[model samples]
Target: MAPEMISIHGGVFRMGSDRFYPEEGPVHEVAVEPFELDATPVTVAQFAAFVDATGYVTTAERP
Candidate 1:
């Protein structure tokens, strides 16, 4: 199926995991420019297609 284009407005957000990780701390706010995020997690079919197209091996395949 052909992909559809979507428009989204930009906004500021506090991004972090709320963990001891120093980078994640401070809970600082950020102004993120408009961009597209995947609407959902990758499906099995999508993963298969990626592996097939690139013959891309994942770390799991390594001992």
Candidate 2:
């Protein structure tokens, strides 16, 4: 069975930081829209199965 997904409501919030790193500096406001997210995390076995089924190779596997 598929994992349950929950709806997230859109809202405005402050993001980033100026006190931490230079790249993450300059805190700013961010607005996000409603979205659905899975309630459960995917297992390693599941990911392996997907890779096998799709014949996908990771970057590390590349020469």
Candidate 3:
């Protein structure tokens, strides 16, 4: 099955929480350009299948 995908429009959105962990503190607005993302998490098996079928190498695998 194909993975579901979503399109994100360019905009600024508040991220992180000031009341949470220290690392997550200082809540701020982040600007992002348009992008695409998978609507749901991809499984390892599914990822492997796609890579194998496409003979694709991930950036991490590069020497």
lDDT, candidate 1, residue 43? 82
Candidate 2: list runs displaced more than 4 Å.
44-63
The full ranking of all candidates by TM-score, starting with the best, is: 2, 3, 1
lDDT of 3 by residue, 1-63 (tens): 666789989999999997869999688999999999999988899899889899999999899
Q: State how far residue 14 of model 2 sits from its true place (Å).
A: 0.7
Candidate 1: clashing pairs of residues:
none
At residue 57, what lDDT does model 2 achieve? 90
**lDDT by residue (tens digit), candidate 1, 1-63:** 634545677999997766778777778789978976555576899889989999998998977
How many clashes in each candidate? 0, 0, 0
Model 3, which residues run further than 4 Å from truth? 11-33
Model 1, poorest ten-residue lDDT window? 1-10
Model 2 lDDT at residue 3: 79
TM-score of each: 0.44, 0.64, 0.54
lDDT (Cα atoms) of all candidates against the true structure: 0.79, 0.90, 0.90
